[model samples]
Target: MTTLGNMKVHEITRDYGIDGLSITERNIPSLSARQVLVRLDAVSLNYRDLLIIKGIGRWRPPAGRVPLSDGVGTIVETGSEVQQLTLNDRVAGLFFPNWKEGAVTTEKTHDPLGGPTRDGVLQEYVMFEEDQVVKVPSYLTPAEAATLPCAALTAWNALIEKGKIHPGKTVLIQGTGGVALFAAQFSLISGAQVILLSSSDEKLERARELGISQLINYKKTVNWEKAVLDMTGGKGVDHIVEIVGGNNVDRSISALAPNGLISQIGVIDGLKGEIEISKLMPKEGMVQGVQVGSREMFLRMNQAITLTQLHPVVHKIYPLSAIKEALTELEQGNHYGKICISAERNQ
Candidate 1:
């Protein structure tokens, strides 16, 4: 919050990967009119963060870019022109700050937070317009709130906002990652039945504690679609959160009920794959691509979280100095929830 003092930020250098990361001190930037200074308290890692860190494909940021897409912070200093926000208000930045409402566009999707074009929250302080950030639920801690910007909102947009997932609907979620678990939780909240798929039995058991009764081990039962069809009495599922892309989508299509919706959220398997249109046509299956949501959607999600007292599942929290370890843990794909970075001076 003090422009007079030097602040430490983790930067991406030419080397790339964990070795490429360097922490250096620079002058804390001054805020302009309409921009409020935020002291970021926490950061959460996403699969996309791993891609950015590894310098994969289009995810490769320019040299000296700061990486991370999700964070929760407090307004340490408010600009003179800023309104509707007071000092000490806790908030999370929107992944797509320009996509404030309704319908997406090329312009709205540009300059995403913590992506190649913009600096992220790994630093001690962030600056944004009051409109670019939304107040988090009062009951949620910084780490829990940190997970909302990307993973939580993506799941919400996929299930609640677009799919209208509720009672009488059966949702099949793939994996035990942040978005998948959040989708399972939201599905349960809306009175929908969930069938979750994971390679690990341990993760499946953990999901059971979240009230998910139907679990499938994709590793053991390779043809899990048949299991889904059998469970639904040959009716298939009403929704599928397609986290595993490539050929796995075809399998999801095989397990869809008539008019079922599949929210395409990830590409862990492969980026490009062909879909068998004949299968989808018979079921009228809809595959909707989901992006992290807007400010309006984030606010609505915060309200629902407040009402339900829902907590984001955090697998682990590492000190800011231990970010490389956090990223490595996320890369290993062993964690069941969001991985976070503590921004405390001593952490």
Candidate 2:
């Protein structure tokens, strides 16, 4: 067991570029009555984290905040009032601590970790209420487990929870990022056909190794929606995991079958766009924006992951000190899957 003491953390010391982040020291936080102290082993980067770090989004945190929402750690100490978890239990912090189950509401969605609200898990040690963390899948390393809290859960919610994807249903996944790949994986797990679109042919080929036969290179075919229509025999896909938020939504609408669902999860291609209402209206399709997911959904997803023995695609790993380089890599958008930060190196 590692000795617990003061911890080193990277904080957004200013609202600027990656250079705004500073590594500093802080005393390990004391646990409250229902809280537990955890030693973070790994943290994963998300597009949202990049937006938050750059102060580019609506949910920008104040300066001096620790920024990141996905991480896994082992409990080193538990408060007397905590009963659900024990020392040495491995768990990942929830993005939205208040969202335990059922439908999301304003109150439940208010406190997102490592953002405009709460502190994230980029530090070596963190204090969270026992309920704010979920057990990591036993088969996964802490780095792999760190990818689940955000990317994996968002894909699961979009495809299984709201999209109601099933066998024979066709799911269209945009890009080959963390969520997109997980969407493909989970869709395949449900016996659904996955048609993944990426600008890079190499990424498309990588998706093929994961059992995705239908791949589309958007760079090669600009009107990829037509390709989708042609591939589905002019019917279009049942679900489209829409990651590109610009005018691409209009294209997604064009590629949807009747009563199909478009799980709008990202805006990587530019935030503002004009939706073709005329095209969307005729299909009677639904476009639902998905937040990561609730704790209940995370638990359910973990159960499925354990049963399937699914492994997340880890594109790269970096030490905590290489946060700027990691963020730069994410900004370039060249990686095929999740990028992780290992706190063990810092320790």
lDDT over C-alpha atoms for residue 222 of model 2: 90
Residue-by-residue lDDT tens digits, candidate 2, 129-200? 889999989889888999999999999999989988899899999999999999999999999999999999
Put down candidate 1 lDDT per residue, 18-130, tens digits, no spaces.
Answer: 77889987777888878888889999999998788779998999988988989999898888889889999998888997989988788998999989999888898888987
| Winning candidate number (TM-score) | 1
Q: After superposition, how far is residue 179 of candidate 1 from its true place, in Å?
A: 0.7
lDDT of each: 0.91, 0.91
Model 2 misplaced stretches (Cα beyond 4 Å)? 1-3, 345-347
lDDT of 2 at 338: 97
Residue 102 displacement (Å), model 1: 1.3
Q: Judge candidate 1 against the unseen true structure and give its global Cα lDDT, from 0 to 1.
A: 0.91
- Clash list (residue pairs), candidate 1: none
Q: What is the TM-score of each candidate against the true structure?
A: 0.98, 0.97
